[model samples]
Target: MNAPTSPHILAAAQRPIPDAFMAALTARFGSQCVTSLAVREQHGRDEGSLTAPPPAAVVYAESTQDVQDAVALCHQHEVPVIAYGAGSSLEGHLLAVQGGISIDVNRMNQVLSIDTEDLTITVQPGITRKQLNEAIKDTGFFFPIDPGADASIGGMASTRASGTNAVRYGTMRENVLALEVVTASGQVIRTGNRAKKSAAGYDLTRLMVGSEGTLGIFTEISLRIYPLPEAVSAAICSFSTIEAAVRTVIETIQLGIPIARVELIDVNAVRMVNAYSKLDLREEPMLLMEFHGSPTGVKEQAEMVQDLASEHGGNAFEWAERPEDRTRLFTARHNAYFAAVASVPACRCITTDTCVPISRLADALLQCVTEADASGIPYFLVGHVGDGNFHFGYLIDPDNDTQRAQAEQLNHQLVQRAIALGGTCTGEHGIGVHKQGFLLEEAGEGAVAMMRAIKQALDPKNILNPGKIFQIG
Candidate 1:
């Protein structure tokens, strides 16, 4: 099957940015408003293959009021407003598809409040996961939702991002407790609250968690934090084949091992990582795992997983107990995407995120692997396999149309198979411009219509991140 094209792929019309809007933006934000081509260029694109023109202006929002003012100006002028955080999104999330302005929130980085007694922390949207952990390092707690990149908390919330820890800790959808959002018209509204559970009203927090900036801009976020695990141990086990590694993950999850973090890195990705990260690791299909709990509990869990690996023809486990050692191993795993991209100079990656049920993971992954190998497209594979989510980074030279089409076709096939196997086209990366067609394929017409209705109600003008997720009106 040919790759599906997003309806607006080549047809997104740029809306006019009136001089009056610029005047208002300049008057309100002053130096914070930047119209330089360089700055606008930086804000206009994310770490994705899709490209679009830069926004007309970029506003550095230092406070919630600043975001409100900028968004209000855009709303009044009928201009689109795309929220900008760390700009680490893998999909085309930051593209100014229809042209307007970008609200950069990196200046808003701050920890607003931390309630250790309640196991919660309220933070400005700009704070990155690593920074949050550093601020609360002395408090015996850490935020668990890590999407690898030092993505801003707001970006993570917008994408409902989950990472290596998701198998045990859950995604942003579960951990985010409350939000202070600026509506499409610049009205500030709070969704949910610090309370753990509430039955009072619609779950607006849930609605906005993965809205991908289409509904509103997140100004503040409160997240559930977890106490540091009593014992943390990490290990890597190589396997003879990709199926063996994936099968081990499926069986481990089925056996209910409570594995904290289990990741799969195929041979090509491992080779790239070794070159990029300058670490000597087993260049084979490998499972990198971590165990968390009390000392005895961690030991028992590790022993059980080790036995399972051996049963599946996995090599002897290589353990990392020193904190620094464990950090080194995971840091490489997190950098796998970049490594793969850099391996081929001047090549852009079309990454795929497909998640299937644990029982179907082997079938889904093995089939995709076979197809990718047959297609001869250079690719790297890595996954948070414990939760049945994986990524394939297809590296293709930008000038080669045939290579790009091949990568997209591979991505399409994987997403369709994932959907058929009771999975999502996207596990963590939100549906940005690149995945709009996949969203339609997976959600069907009726469900997408409801989503469009919600977007219409929340953003009547379609001024908030217009032309993303789906075409509005």
Candidate 2:
């Protein structure tokens, strides 16, 4: 393996900014408000391999009033305002496309209220999923929108993120009860309440859940919580082929198994995990499984899934019940992307996620793998298969034109296949410039026009995270 090269370092350094912008920002916000260049650059991009121009300035906001004032100032100056969180998004969602003020929300991390009776928690948007969960640990309840990253609740809500547990707990769309947002006009408004359901006027809460921060900046969030199960068990099951593993997942879901986490890892990913994590495991297609319920319920559920796996020629099921063991298992799975990148130094990681119907998952995955092999691109496969969503991480040398072309070809073919099979180009990761064209292809021109109209109606000034989900005309 070769040493990693900073491909976009020079370009990022050369990115220009307005001379008076920093002075104005400092005048408005004290010296402590602005972060150093290292911090600004760190908050500018996400885990995705795409390079983006860093923001002209980053503001450390501490409260909703601060966010509102900052946004109002940007709106007045005709500058873009990008909300910054933990920078864990996978589609370059945090990139300062228009390069203006980045409202860093990490300072606002605080759990304001936890209503045990209502099973809801009100927290500042910058609070991460892990932090929230730890805070609520002793309450016998937990938030379930786990996006594999310790991502901020605000970022997760913006992206409408879901993860391995989505099959059972749903995504941020269902888990977020309400949101306190600063609109494009810089007015602060509450979207919803603690009520379980409502027939409100416009359902603005749901609309903003997946808006990718293009419409408003979330200051605080009210999230639905679930009672921590009486028992939790995780397992790993191997299969002879990727087809068999996917087929088993489809069958299990069709059977309505209450699986908490059912992820699919192709043989290639298993190989990478072995090399990166130093675990001597079978180099075959595998499924990382989990169940959350009462002891009896989890036992019965595991039995049912085991029988289904057996029908698909799956190998012996190895279960992990201890918390440490469970953590080790998921830690490896969560680090799968980093492991794949580690396989080839000096390579940029380009990952694409697509969701298909459960029945067509095997066919879709087979086509993706076939195209990847034919193009001779080094890639690894892993996904939340229970929900029919998967990701392909392609390792490419960006300087090599042939490698770049091959990766693009594979990405195009994979997305086309997904759309043709009545699936979406992206399931969790929002269309943050990387998939704008594919989104247009997936949702026809009329749909795109309607989306643009909504954007205009909500954000007439176009100051909130401009040039994100859609191209402004």
Candidate 3:
């Protein structure tokens, strides 16, 4: 197994946007070019805790050539270029600290191809996950990498995102097969073919998937998709303690039960969702699970998981098999973060993401929950525990320095513990600006040096999404 790479890195010192670059962008994009403070601010920060200076301008790019032309202009002046997808990033991935031009790809959203024969769909980067599935729904195949948010495929590729179904369907790394990227010099390049696997050369496709746009901007993506399951069922099992809920998940995974999705929502999260989404779920540590297979197979999978949970003193699994019922269950889980923050007035959700080996999940999660509770910070717990990944949203009063400090302290300790247990600093959420320190601790100097070398080789001018993942200088 590879040593985990760090998820986030420090924001590198940024250079001022060249005046000539702005003139060039405005000239090239015309009406699409926006330089208003209000527009720039809109393109600046993400859903993360960090606040960065907005870009000097934002250009809506409607085609691959537009991206190349914009990149060319930026490359000419050695200006930074940040790719903007759906603006749904959680790690400040879209912050334009150096102030360049943001290339908004939302207009490029179009279903380019759907080859059901190969079970692959080629799409523009800006297409959201939900839209992609709906477009491909009638074909009997669906894109399964659901990262809770209807995040853009381009952003999802950049961040290497995953969600509850990752345990079964895998993350972006497993689902993404090929890509079309615009390099720093505005060169368009194809990373891989539509083949199932390749050993022809460097796995550039995988490299670009999680490059976080530091290397190049994704213009198109080809994703390997799966057929819709024959039968799907969702359930929830409430546990008296977080330890018990997590242990049940660990046991289920150890036993090789093919559960499609397994999520952990603690008591606070349950309460928030109950009030926010208006669903009266038991306010305790709970496991939200889904099973996919033939009717009998789904039943067996659910039963096996139920027995495992029961052994841990979990309540009887509440089943939600109908489509509407299933949607209600997952919707609450999807909105868990917002619900948590909304539960506390004037609070911000500072999240910590850590994923460990299945063997270490029980201990790792227990330690995390205990420390978070001990800090006396109002927080909610949720996890894609089927894959040994989990998140804690530290709901903090943003104005309260002491509360912020406590949350960061707890997050730091948990990240170190995850690293010790052979887990990545980030499970699904890619490093943006917040986890830069933890990235160093996870990936050693040598590995990070290699990454820096790659960044320099691919983007010599440092024009493409600079100061992300790992800073070049």
Candidate 1, residue 252: lDDT: 92
Q: Candidate 1 on 47-143: residue-level lDDT in tens?
A: 8888888999999999999999888898899999999999999788999989999999998999999999999999999999999999999999999
Q: After superposition, how far is residue 22 of candidate 1 from its true place, in Å?
A: 0.5
Using Cα atoms with residue i matched to residue i, what is each candidate's TM-score against the true structure? Answer: 0.98, 0.95, 0.97
Rank all candidate structures by their lDDT, best first, as comma-separated numbers: 1, 3, 2
Best by lDDT: 1
In model 1, state the lDDT of residue 382: 94
* lDDT of the structure predicted as candidate 2: 0.86
Clashing pairs in 3: 8-436, 9-436
Displacement of the residue 413 alpha carbon in candidate 2, Å: 0.9
lDDT (C-alpha, whole model) for all candidates: 0.93, 0.86, 0.88
Q: Candidate 3, which ten residues in sequence have the lowest lDDT sum?
A: 1-10
- Give the per-residue lDDT of model 3 (tens digit) for 1-473: 32233222324456777677777778889999998999888888788777777888889999999999999999989888899988888888898866677999999899999999998999999999999999888899999999998899999999999998999999999989999999999999999999888789899998998888898999999999898999999999999998899889888998999999999999999999999999989888899999999999998999898888889999957999899999999999999988987889988778989999998998898878778878889999899999999999998887776777777788888899999999988998888777777787899878888988998998888878877777766
Counted clashes in each candidate structure: 0, 0, 2
What is the per-residue lDDT of model 2 for residues 198-254, given as tens digits with 9 covering 90 to 100? 998989999999999998999989999999999999999999988888888898899
Per-residue lDDT value at 10 in model 3: 26
Worst 10 residues of 1 by lDDT: 1-10
